[model samples]
Target: MTQYLAKYFALHRKLVLPGIGFFNTSTQPAQLEFVEKTLHAPVHTINFWQDENVADNNFISFLIKETGLNHYETINKFSQFITGLKEKLQSGVALKIPGLGILTNNENGYSFNPENLQQYFPGITAERVIRQNAQHSVRVGEDEKTSVEMHEMLNKEVVKDRWWIGAIVLAVVGVAAILYYYLSR
Candidate 1:
């Protein structure tokens, strides 16, 4: 029963335990830390909301199929289970759902603390690798160009801009040579 509930929540990423609360799983995408040069792994968080109006029709149907029980029997069994949990919660006992989290009745209302998934899903150390001279497609405005082609084009422009400097140096060297020849003669 608990295992089936956990399995259903895992598969659907959402679960509604009637008269209690609803659970939802949200994903935080992996991020790159530029200064640290590390890529952080994505995280999946299970959030519990105390919404009493959440419908459990789909969940009941799922349990019926999984438990191989008729709809009325399944409902009766699940209602009994929920009633037991409610009784314990009202008596100031924290209920821990296996593979889920701890649910406690607080001064404010029902408070839920999610399980730490890091133990089951450990983060791996991922480092960013950048190739300096690698040729890859890049979008330049609306046109696609190879990185090598762009590098060549940029280098050509640099050389073209500095052509006058080389010409001036050569002219100075030629004038010095002419001066030496004329003085020697």
Candidate 2:
């Protein structure tokens, strides 16, 4: 299969035909809808697209073009290829065809979807499923200690400023008393 794809790429200078089976890249617009009788905010969705022409062709035609094999031989070859792919899926590795992209198990691991296939095709249903992963907890023991120490230092500076202000007020009162004593003398 690799050799066949390589030959096609070498001849066409592309992995797939431009219009027949090219890759499509587009961003799906965020949509808003009601949820639980309340309006839900819209969120952007990342979408990938690929051509359906590659999958549209029957196995026999592919075999005839690539291997120059007869109809019976082509069917047998395709069957074996599909069986091998299933075995690979059992091992947890997804199969990625060059122009078609990935084929992997869905969130349930029972059904599969082509990663790059477009959702707009007739009779095709593309559903996005969310998967949850393990949560992580962070601890900051030493960092918290340092932050507390910094807070204490700032407090001491504030106290020092208050002391300086008190000393200035005392000096001003002493000057006022001396001025009154001189005037009385």
Candidate 3:
């Protein structure tokens, strides 16, 4: 079951270890780190969501196929695997999965101890852009632009970004509907 989980994690959208925790992937966008003074390329990273034994969208579907078991059987097997993993985590054992991470649970919270999986973000190989001239600053003082103005600018950018995202989503949805319509016809 653990090996099946490993394959599922490698191939699927999400993994649910019922009663343990949920795992999902998220993008850490390419951004400028002020403290580090480096522009990091976007990276895909796994996040551990502390959730109940409740099912998620992709968990059971992957399990059904990977385990080659019926829905009820897969669920039962998944539940057992999760119970073991939780026990291991609570007992201070770091459960390690390749390409994923070691998971450890302390008194306060459970954490996924990912082992350097960010070395490569799948399908994205943006070169880390660096500045040769490390020392440079544009101090936007109150005289040039007030904090309120800067905030307003940021708000406008947010709205613009939201509009673009909405447009893209609608476009995708529209295309999907059209394809479905034509295919069904």
TM per prediction: 0.66, 0.31, 0.52
Candidate 2 has an lDDT of 0.50
- State the lDDT of candidate 2 residue by residue for 1-185, as single tens digits: 54664355434434432122333333454343424233223322222333434542433465478898887886677667656766776677776655435555445543324343334322323354454442334336554334445555557854234678889999999999999999999
Q: Considering only N, C-alpha and C atoms within 3 Å, which residue pairs clash in candidate 1? A: none
* Candidate 2 TM-score over all chains jointly: 0.31
Q: Give the best candidate by lDDT.
A: 1
TM value for model 1? 0.66
lDDT of 3 by residue, 1-185 (tens): 66766677777746776666778787777776666555667776788877765576476787797668899997787778778887888789988876678788888677786656656633333456775535443348544655555556667744234678889999999999999999998
What is the lDDT, from 0 to 100, of the residue 115 in candidate 1? Answer: 89
Please identify which of the two predictions, 1 or 2, would achieve the higher TM-score against the true structure.
1
Poorly placed runs, candidate 1 (over 4 Å): 127-185
- Stretches of candidate 3 off by over 4 Å are 29-41, 120-185
- Each candidate's root-mean-square deviation in Å? 5.9, 15.8, 29.1
The per-model lDDT (C-alpha) reads 0.86, 0.50, 0.72
Query: What lDDT tens digits, residue by residue, belong to model 1 across residues 1-102?
Result: 788889999889998988878998999987777776666677888899897767779889999999999999999999998888889999999988877899
